[model samples]
Target: MSENEHSCYRCGDDLPGHARAWDYLLPDPVALLSDEEQDRLIGVRTEQVVTASGVGNFIRVILPVPLDTGHTATFGVWLCVTSRPEWQAVIGAARAGGETWSGYTFSGRLATAVAPWPEVFGARATAVAPGPGLVAQIRRSDERRLARVLTQVWPDSEILAARERGHVPGVMTGDRPRWRDWWRRGRRKTH
Candidate 1:
């Protein structure tokens, strides 16, 4: 395996496989918005473009669990840069401010499988390359939690519930065990 083909023991996802370590490159216009611009979105600084290379230079944000329940899947947020200049600039700013961002404890929210999702620790930046984008993933073990989180995030969506009857309303009705089976199987497999 190449240097970056580390397996995610938690999720079983083969990230940056040995053969494709350099394949997932990302490049485009990159900029770091000020605090005001960052906060203008749904969440405050939920995402950021880092113009530097260091620990904590990137961040993954996990949404907070709602107050009613405490079991939902967590979403992921990444603060990254798509260009070398962006990374360098952010790193420079950190150094100039006498701020050491390396080794910082960054964590994201988890889907609780229902209401309030749990918290998850983020991986550290062991390597940085100007391609393949800063690929972040939800741990494989967190799949079920993530499903629940997604469901909670959209209550009326019925992602986990049975699909609407395939037959036309008031037109035709018959046993659709196949469809039912599909949903059951899918939900089970996801969980």
Candidate 2:
């Protein structure tokens, strides 16, 4: 790898040229549903949780929590425009050793298999890379499918925002991905 090459935070494989990274937000495994709704959603997959906050609201709670019905969960995605079929396998390897899902404090601690989720890098905050995290990588043509798959995983989640996004400096927190930040970065370069 050359100094110009940027390797994946998880896979350590050299990223192909022309790869475009993006971020999308999505609901946590548990959304803001009543007890009945949560049961209906995850069913038998989870156990009861105990918190020190005299019953933490985040327990089994939807991501970007507090139940933003009008908001869509976001995720980060990278479009690796490469024909190398092995890239998928390499990504899987990176994910295998990564921590994509969070809230084990509420989800219980048996330790389950790992899965990937979108994360941000560069300016603003960094997910996965702060340690090891997961994100999706796909061909440019399959972006829509990626969205569908993301939603399909959480049936009870109410989604209001879902799209490719760029992070901004001091503005792109895990809860927010301001699209205008991308343009702002370019504007700064010109000025």
Q: Best by lDDT, which number?
A: 1
Cα misplacement distance, residue 118 of candidate 2 (Å): 16
Cα lDDT tens digits for candidate 1, 1-191: 34564555546566543211111111010122234533442122223332222211343323322222333422333433223454465445434432234322222221112212212212111222212233233322344544444334443223123122211111011332232232223222211
- In order of appearance, the predictions have TM-scores of 0.19, 0.19
* Candidate lDDT (C-alpha), each: 0.28, 0.27
Residue ranges of candidate 1 with Cα displaced over 4 Å: 1-9, 12-58, 67-69, 79-191
Model 2: how far is 17 from its true place, Å?
2.1
RMSD of each: 18.6, 19.5
TM-score of 2: 0.19
Prediction 1 TM-score vs. true: 0.19
lDDT assessment of candidate 1: 0.28
